[model samples]
Target: MIISFVQTKGGTGKSTLALSTAFSNHMNSAFGSVALVELDPQGTLRNWWNERTELGRDTGRVSFHHISSSQKEVFADGIKAIATHNDLIVMDIPGESTGKLHTRFACAVSDLVIIPMRTSTNDEAAFADNLYPIIKEILKVDPGKKGCFYVLPSFTHPKANRDTIMGYFTDILPPHVGCLRTIYPDRSVYENFNREGATLADYAYSVRENKRHSKQALSAAGDVEEIARAITQMLEKEHVSAKKEEATLRG
Candidate 1:
């Protein structure tokens, strides 16, 4: 499974989500092993992986690569090679539309493309103004794509009007565009833990040592696990369905 997490606007937690999913799968052996690709010029994910490695964390099962290229052909070739060698590749690209054809190529090869946005007014407005057209372009450029796009609501708060916001988003979302059932809440633990170059799954501290943090820590960990599991299962279903379609067509 090749997965790409993208958003046109910055600060939508796209990098964090990509890293979390990759680490969660790596630590859990979620997809046997995983490759983490950093295509973003910002190199945020690369820095985090380096810090984590320097902290003596084991990244044996996780392969990390930072490819700094904007040329469409180079990026397309890079993605093709990565997809060939790795069963799963999670790519974090630049959070802007001008990153060029690499973004569209990534979407073309991906098993799933996650477009995360916060529930804030700015994010909503940006998603409305920019995202759909980008998706439209991807379909035009990569017309043979077998993958689909999903809108992920990130950094949602309980105090906000989530239902109303989601309903509006759903109403406007075009066909084949879906929403993720799991919403990533704006939690301090997610920020604080990752700031120290540790994933929630690999936090190293005992889940039971701190009584006050026990439930919250475990719940946060569960959120990552749920996402990893959901993504893996979705890929499996697609593979199975694809194989069946191939068999029917051959018959």
Candidate 2:
């Protein structure tokens, strides 16, 4: 699966979603592998991978790459080569539509595109004015692409007016837009995941740092599991559909 976490609205936590999804998928699989392609110039994911190595942790079936602008075509070629050998490749990218680097290619090739937004007026407006246009443009470019598109609500307030946020999404985007079943609350566990250089799946089994019983880690573990399951279902469905289409063509 080639999953890309993207948004045109900056600071909406696209990197967080990409890391969480990538590593969660990594730590759970018995034999499946994950490769994280960091297209974001900030290099947050690249830095965290370094931290994980310094901690003497098993980077286990996971690799990180920081792609520079001068080498986008090379980066794209590398990602395609990796995809053939890996079970998952999660691409983390900046939240901007117009960039000098080659992001339109990334948008075209993703198997799944995730857009994260916070529950606020600014984010709501951005989804309408920015993210929606980006998605629309991608479809225009690749009208026959088979991919899943999602908008995830991130950094949700505990006391947030849930209905109002839901209403805004329903109003701005068309109805029946699929959202991740779980919302990422503003939690310290997510903050500490990379700070601790571990995924929530790792945290669930991390008895060394008392992460196994850490209340914050424990709470977030369920969220990660549910999201992973959702991702798995989507990927499987897409594969099955593709196989059927191919079989029909032969018939």
- Highest TM-score model number: 1
> Model 1, range 200-243, lDDT digits (tens) per residue?
66663645677666666666777777666766766776678778
On a 0 to 1 TM-score scale, where does candidate 1 land against the true structure?
Answer: 0.84
The digit string of per-residue lDDT tens for model 2 on 1-251 reads 78777777677777777777676743348237888888877778888888888888777777777775656677778787888888788888886744624455566777767667776778778677766665667677765453467666678764456566666555665432456555666776676666657776676666446744576776776666666676677667767877888899899
Each candidate: what lDDT? Answer: 0.72, 0.69
Instruction: Tell me the lDDT of candidate 1.
Output: 0.72
Residue 159, candidate 2: alpha-carbon lDDT: 48
TM-score of candidate 2 relative to the true fold: 0.81
Model 2 residue-pair collision total: 0
Candidate 2 backbone collisions, by pair = none
Q: Who wins the lDDT comparison? A: 1
For each of the candidates, the C-alpha root-mean-square deviation to the true structure, in angstroms, is: 3.0, 3.5
- Candidate 2 wrong stretches, greater than 4 Å: 25-27, 70-72, 97-103, 158-168, 174-177, 201-213, 245-251
* CA-RMSD of model 2: 3.5
